[model samples]
Target: MRINVLQHTPNEGPGSIQRWSQEHGHEMYIYHPYQFGNLPTSDQTDMLVILGGPMSPNDDLDWIEQERVLIRQLLADHKPIFGACYGAQQIAKTLGYAIKKAPHKEVGWAPVYLKSDIIPGIPEKLTALHWHEEMFEVPDQADLLFSSDLVKNQGFIMNGNVIGLQFHFEPEADNVREIAINDNQYPLEHNDLHQTGKEIIDHGVPTENKQVMYQLLDFMVKNS
Candidate 1:
């Protein structure tokens, strides 16, 4: 499979997604719109994977608009398009859904409940990594797949073309370290919605989450 990845920041990369894509012999073409400028036409991309970023979808930027145009074009074509966090918000914004500041800033390892088991092998209770403060609503034609106490709309699926995840399922230890070090503003409060770097490292749920990420990616590749 030829996968086109939209990488907003150098740090917030594909993580486990890169390993999966390479291991499965899938060709990945990465577009660094933040560092460079523009993205290639969707006609050349068989599948699209938008990685997370630190910026909000509402941020008025030229690159943001360009990425959204690509996302909109991909979804309109009914092609497989997956998004994480900021990428998810881009999907929601492209689909005309609401994007706003979440009630709580969710950082580190947190438990979420699946509302719909659209993908196989996903547990009802999952501990995924969170690093964003913005939340998006489920699009009009999409199914709400997951939710948590802090964020109501965790993920959504529209047919097999569009998938949005508000949390990080692909972050490994090294990736988590990069994320923690890159964003000092990301809260580490010992509260209901946040956890420190040491706490997240001590919690060994990311290993499990990475496996679930693989399953979901496989399902999306085959079914989408």
Candidate 2:
């Protein structure tokens, strides 16, 4: 399988997802739109993985619009797409859903609750890294998959091929540290909602959440 990852920034790379791709002997390609100024042709991609970013989906950036077009094309072709955080927001916006500010920003490590056992190949609950000030509405055609206390719509799946997660399932220990130090711009008041740098590292890799990514990849590979 060839996995094409659309990276928005240097810090928010593929992280654990990269490891999963390599372990499965799948080719991993990264596109840094911020640095490269363009996206790959849809012909070159099989499964698309859109990573997180600090920017909001509403930002009137040229690359954002271009990526939106690419997302629409991927959906039209029935290509499997997995989007996280800002990428999820972009997916929501492109799918005709709305993205707006949440009541409170979700930062640090948080436990995401399973709304249903419909997650056939993954576990029920998992702790996922989160760093976002904006939230998105689930598309009418999609099913709500997971939710956290801070955010009701943590994830949604469309046509079982397109998955959007608001939390960071691909986060590494270093990624958590970087987000903790730099995400101070988004104020989070609830202490329980926050996690110390050491805490996030101590928790280590989210094995269950990582399995979800693997399951998603498996589904994509079989279906695609």
Per-model TM-score, in order, reads: 0.93, 0.90
lDDT for position 8 in model 2? 87
Give the CA lDDT, 0 to 100, for residue 77 in model 2. Answer: 91
Tens-digit per-residue lDDT, 1-224, candidate 1: 88999998877888888899989999999989888986978798788898898788899989999988988788777788889999999999998888998887888778889888677778899888888888998998999988988889999988855789999898887887777777745655434565676666666555578788888788777765
lDDT, candidate 1, residue 144?
93
Clashing pairs in model 2, backbone N/Cα/C closer than 3 A: none
Error of 1 at 5 (Å): 1.2
- Give lDDT for model 2: 0.81
Error (Å) of candidate 1 at residue 119 is: 1.9
Error of 1 at 66 (Å): 0.8
State how far residue 19 of model 2 sits from its true place (Å): 1.2
